[model samples]
Target: MTTRYIDAGVNLTSSQFDDARDDIVMRAKQAGVDNMLLIGTNTQDSMHCLQLARHYGFVCTSGIHPHDAKSTQADYIAQLKTLFLHPEVVAVGECGLDFNRNFSPRSEQISVLSQQLELAEQNNLPVYLHERDAFDAMRAQLEQVKVHGVLHCFTGDKHALDFYLHYGLMIGITGWVCDERRGAQLQQLVPLIPDDRLLIETDAPYLLPRTLKPKPKSRRNEPAFVEAIVREVARLRGQSCEHVAKISHANFQRLFITRRGTQ
Candidate 1:
């Protein structure tokens, strides 16, 4: 029997998908990934993601990623509110700090993230969070705001993982767990995520699972490969793939769909 899975995150609007969108979704369905949440990094892409979600019958988020913080307009929050009003745009982020790259200045990243958190609270929407080498700063902001959602594509140490878990966020595991190298820390942290708080994502067009057999020539990840992430997470946590898939799907619904009164 095949386990129906939901990819908690996917960047379907990326140019890599171009004209292959329909085929990508079909392949994901065939691979047992029956649903996916397309990510929105900025306002434009958030709108695009919502369109794709509605057209393809998936869910999506609306917010500005910290990397794009510098490009924010004065009415960004208002824009996000408008997007959030759409049934298809279920969360308020892909918004958080990323000191690792610091594409946007640290101050700008923090300011923008705080604004998004305020929007999430005001709109009563869950958030789709991200953080990299900025747990201290992210934790500080989280201390001031209370919201629900998944910490997408998590790749932090147990210390950071424990904090997020305690703070009431679902942990989103990705292909990083399949890496035999840098994924070592994340692999060790996997078993600690409670089943109810676990989620899975491909972060597709990125982080292709190293364990995937007959890897794609383009090396660009897609929603169809999320099953590989599920299998690896299952193995690392000593759980059955079906069990992991089922729970992750349930968790996604609890966080995104059920709250909105639909699946």
Candidate 2:
């Protein structure tokens, strides 16, 4: 039997899909990607993602990204509260820290992340976290709050992976795992994630899998390519693609759906 997939993260609101959104989603479905979680990086984008989710019967997340942390207004949490009322908004982020670029000041990123964590705890929503070269600070903030979510597109070291797992986060793997060079560490670490705590994503329009054969003419990633990540993860873990798919799908459903079954 063929394994079906659920994309844990997709930036379907990206301008790259401007005239091709419908086709992109259709292709994803044809490729066995039956569901996806649209990611919203800011309030306006979150609204756009929510609209798309409603239109397509997909789930979505709403929050300020670390890159946009400085732009977080005092009323940002209020804005998120409104977004959360919609049934399609399943998580509280795309929010976390990125010291690599530090587009936003470190202080601002922490402040915005803390507020989002508060929103998650208050509303009983899981978070969709992001961290880039800022794990120390991110871990500090996480320790202060009780929030649960996937660490989306994780490409960190074993230490970071263990920390998140110990903290009870489901790990999200992407095409980065398919990169022979940059993904070397991830390849070695794939088996470390237990079956029940692993999730898969494309982070579409980005992180195109380097292992994709007969690659598309354009470099833009999409939900359909998520299968490649699943395949690689399965290969590294010495499991069947079917097993990985089922486990990841179950993990996704449990984290984003079952936990909120009461809502």
* Cα lDDT computed for each candidate against the true fold: 0.92, 0.93
What ranges in model 2 sit over 4 Å off?
A: none
- Measured over all alpha carbons after superposition, the RMSD of each candidate to the real structure, in angstroms, is 1.2, 0.8
Model 2 scores a TM of: 0.98
Candidate 1 residue pairs in clash (backbone atoms < 3 Å): 205-221
Q: What lDDT tens digits, residue by residue, belong to model 2 across residues 1-263?
A: 56799999999999999989999999999998888999999999999999999999999999999999988778888999999988889999999999999999999999999999998988889999999999999899999988889999898999999999999999999999999999999999999999989999999999999989879998899999888998899999999899999999999999998877777
Work out the TM-score per prediction.
Answer: 0.98, 0.98
What is the model-wide C-alpha lDDT for candidate 1? 0.92
Model 1: per-residue lDDT, tens digit, 96-168? 9999999999999999999999888877799999999999999999999898888988998888988999999
- Superposed Cα deviation of residue 132, candidate 2 (Å): 0.4
Off by over 4 Å in 1: none
* Model 2 CA lDDT for position 253: 92
Tell me the deviation in Å of residue 58 in model 1: 0.5
